[model samples]
Target: MDSVREQLQIFVRRFGLLNATCCEACCGEDVSLVQSHILFEIRRMGEPSMQQVAEELGIDVTTFSRQVKAMEGDGLVTRRPSERDRRVSLLGLTDEGRRVLVRIDRYMAEKIGQIFSVMTPFEREVTTRSLALFNEALAKVGEAASDGKNIACCN
Candidate 1:
């Protein structure tokens, strides 16, 4: 198998290209890539704590906390005490964040549709079915749940 760095680099490169054509147009800034990723996932998952995002993305709590703070400064995302757990801060997309999320999601869906248009009927069917397996496997295995507190990485 190839190295993990190789896999990550490929994923990041493709992500940059995807955002350049879709997210960048709506956000008007290339640096918004990571912010969009965080905002999109949080919206989809409902209001997760900053710790949950850091856990899911394999980032340090301090790092994601700073990033969320910057987004708050920009008025794109919001933080509030969780009703169920007052000690934890629930991070959610503000109205501005929602607007950009919808736009970027639609753009990427269109981009994927365009890409799949080139595939043969059988290849398309196979690829489409395989995607279900991918999600199924991860849903059964990979989780990014919040613990309301920081956990040591690789512990």
Candidate 2:
């Protein structure tokens, strides 16, 4: 059997997480994979603050701000001062940005459907459950590490 690291590396590459130019069929001609994710998160979260989206994506505030500025220039995103907190900047997508996001979503859903079509129902069920478990396990590990405890779990 392949080592877990080897399998995960292959999975990540296949999922295009490491691709610089990941989305092109979705108006990603000018956007990098990271930028695409930022746009996606902004749209998904419905006008979150600049800091909120940056933290969700695990990007540094400075770098995220730069990317947001670039996207704003491209007319894909807009930032306005928060009414509740004047010091905060709330982010939103333009009409074109929403269209691009929809294209990206449709493309991704089609790809997932193609892959799921080949899997047996049982296999699909197990795979979905396993991925959810994996995410939960990773979140626990992350929380432990953030709290300055490095407890190892082997299962």
Report the CA-based lDDT of candidate 1 relative to the real structure.
Answer: 0.73
For model 1, how does the per-residue alpha-carbon lDDT over 1-155 read when each residue is reduced to its tens digit?
46855964686576564454445664454336667778877987798988788777666888788889998887779999988889999998888877777777877788778878999989989978987986676555544535422233332
lDDT tens digits, residues 1-155, model 2?
Answer: 36987998798888877777778634446678888898899978999999999877777799999999998998889999999999999999999778777878888898888889999999999999999998788778767775423333421
lDDT accuracy of residue 63 in candidate 1:
78
**Model 2: residues >4 Å from true position, as ranges?**
25-28, 147-155
- Count the clashes in each prediction: 0, 0
Estimate TM-scores for all models. Answer: 0.70, 0.87
Q: Which candidate number has the best lDDT?
A: 2
Model 1, position 54, has a per-residue lDDT of: 79
Model 2 local distance difference test score? 0.83
Error of 2 at 52 (Å): 0.7
